[model samples]
Target: MKRKIGWVLAAALLVLLAAGGCAPKTPTAKKKPTPVKTEQKAETVPTYRVVADNNLDKFKQTHGQYRTINYDPQDDLVSLLPESLAKLKKYPQTTTVRAYVTDWQQASVQMGSKPMTVLTVQVQKVLTGKKQLAKQEIRLILPGGFQPYGQYDKGSIYHDNTIPDDEPVLTQNNQIPIPTIGSTIVLPMRKAAQYPAKEYLAWLKAAKLTTAYVPADAHSMIWRCNPQTKKLTTNNPLREKELTKWAGQGNQTWATQYKRLTAELEKQL
Candidate 1:
């Protein structure tokens, strides 16, 4: 009786295995992939301050403003005009243009690490020389604008100055004010190729420009003008001296030179 019972139980187990009742079941739900997170960086703000070259060191031990760092000598107009005209023949603008500052950038000249101001000007009128640049936008580079601030002692700020030197501020030499945007002005311009390896000729090659312009001289090249009134003035003291020199030759006063210059430029136009 016991042997028959065991054989019957074994048969039942075999039948259940053949029917696939013990097989593993497939998963009911699929897993979802995790999403990735990306990080964003913030833009850095630049700090800048304008200071005269003489009064550059104004912390702890104060630097006097009396000394001259880059003083321009009085120019003789009689000699300057002929030489300027001859040089203009080699460069662009044997002519002058009345333009407004559309935009500007401060950069360092690679050769000497000197500061320069690159201006984007829109010509409003042709004052003298030629009319080709009239109503055209152009670029001009000039010396002495802004330079990277040098390292100075920060802990020695006991005297009077409050700012720290190592704070990464751009120290601009404001002896000649940077031409303000939208301000009308007159420029006597020339190609930068004349100053190969010295000025902005090689530095601006990355811009892919055919060429760029520069002033004949740093002092008298820019003249601030009222767009509506057409009154002209310059920030450079040497420019006044040159006009005074011209006035002296004509038996007139320094103030009269402004009108005379305007008349001369208009006659050329």
Candidate 2:
């Protein structure tokens, strides 16, 4: 037993010695120098271009971003309008109904809330024009009513010589109620895609319109219907261009000015 115990002790000692020799060498116990981390610079953002090739999604994505939007000169409408007006102008030949209504007592009745409400309308010309050059029918869309500007009307100012500007500007105070005249009303020629000529012809008669002035270059005709003395005019930009767009270089301007000139021409309706 004593011999065995002595042998076991010797084996343990040899193992310890072997382990010590195998241990990783401590080189003067030198501390590793702390790693110096180079600071990384942030990536630079891109600069904006006027023709940013911005589409609907991009415009929405970058609307409130820090960078300002660069607009093209031909896109003058965007810069001139307030956010709401700009939104409204996104549609062509669209008129908004802006008016109000009210009561003597309770501001809002169960049937309604405020004196009025502004509506986003869809106006389209649903008819084919002279030789299909223009669309003649106009659709007045009033989803609800006039959007209220304020509580008390400040006063009415003249908009044009056609109507007195002194009309009382409505306020929230007055019990008077106003109706949205026309906020978004349009005449789109694309309607023929969905409805055929005979269909629109039926609508034209129902709406009391005519095909009187069928210009050769026009998609639709401008007619004078004596029943309501309603003069229906076809809204055609291409026809307007053929008639009004001057010589070279002016063609581009015509497409831009087409809306305004078309509106004026509609008065001849």
Candidate 3:
């Protein structure tokens, strides 16, 4: 009986050993931790502010009392002849027209000691002109950057600044509090003209108008027609190239119209 019991115990020990040998082995090397990735936030940029003119008091004293002149398309002269036309014969007089300020920009050239504003205006009615120029848009460069003063939207009444004279002032669209037309103020404008009607239609067939801006200057070669004379005037080559590049980035419609007007003029050349 004792021998049988000993054999039984020995069998149990063998079973336990076999179970231990079949078990999986533990790992010897330690596992590495995963690296953490960090994300960064982007920085924001601020808009530029126009430096306020400190000469306001002096300007008021010199120019006299501040009087707001409301815009009146019917009686006010809104467009002026280009400085180039100042000496030209048969040059047309500055005209009064009803127009809207579609957009505005800072004049690339500075005035006296301050920056000027260039307003993009669309003509709605021609109050006074030899030829009625309606449904046209042109650029007008004013004396100062008036954009900071008020909102310039489609409905804003853009009138002459009478107190200082010649400068432009803006009243909110649909809000014309004053109802007076003071001494007329004319905007420095680039007038658009076409080849004579008889010549323009025929010229469009064979030639195309290409419009571009004159560099460092607001004038567009596309808007101005070639003088009636066949002689081509010499231009500053370097300046021309620069303006062309600048116009390439501006309003394409304005450029296209300029090109069309220019192409018509070029036919005469």
Report model 2's TM-score to 2 decimal places: 0.17
- Candidate 3 C-alpha lDDT tens digits along 155-263: 3465223233333343221111211111111221223223246443343322221110111122222122122442222122333454477588874554344345333
Stretches of candidate 1 off by over 4 Å are: 1-79, 82-93, 108-111, 151-163, 167-175, 196-200, 204-210, 241-259, 266-269
TM-score of structure candidate 1: 0.52
For every candidate in turn, the CA RMSD to the true structure comes to 17.1, 24.4, 20.4
Candidate 1 positional error at 264, Å: 2.2
lDDT of each: 0.55, 0.31, 0.36
List, residue by residue over 1-269, the lDDT tens digit for candidate 1: 99999999999999998889867889788777787777676765312112211122332133222221242323344322322333433444455777767666654343354555677777777765667778777777655443323332224344224443333343333335566555677766666766666334556674433366766644545677875665667746555676777777884554454455554554433
Q: Which regions of candidate 2 are displaced past 4 Å?
A: 1-125, 128-150, 153-186, 189-269
Candidate 1: worst 10 consecutive residues by lDDT?
A: 46-55
Best by lDDT: 1
Backbone clash count for every predicted candidate, in the order shown:
1, 39, 3
Candidate 1 whole-model C-alpha lDDT, 0 to 1: 0.55
Model 3 has how many clashing residue pairs? 3
In model 2, what lDDT does residue 70 have? 17
User: Cα lDDT for residue 107, model 3?
Assistant: 56
Each prediction's TM-score versus the true structure:
0.52, 0.17, 0.24
- Residue 259 in candidate 3 has what lDDT? 40
* Residue 13 lDDT (model 2): 100
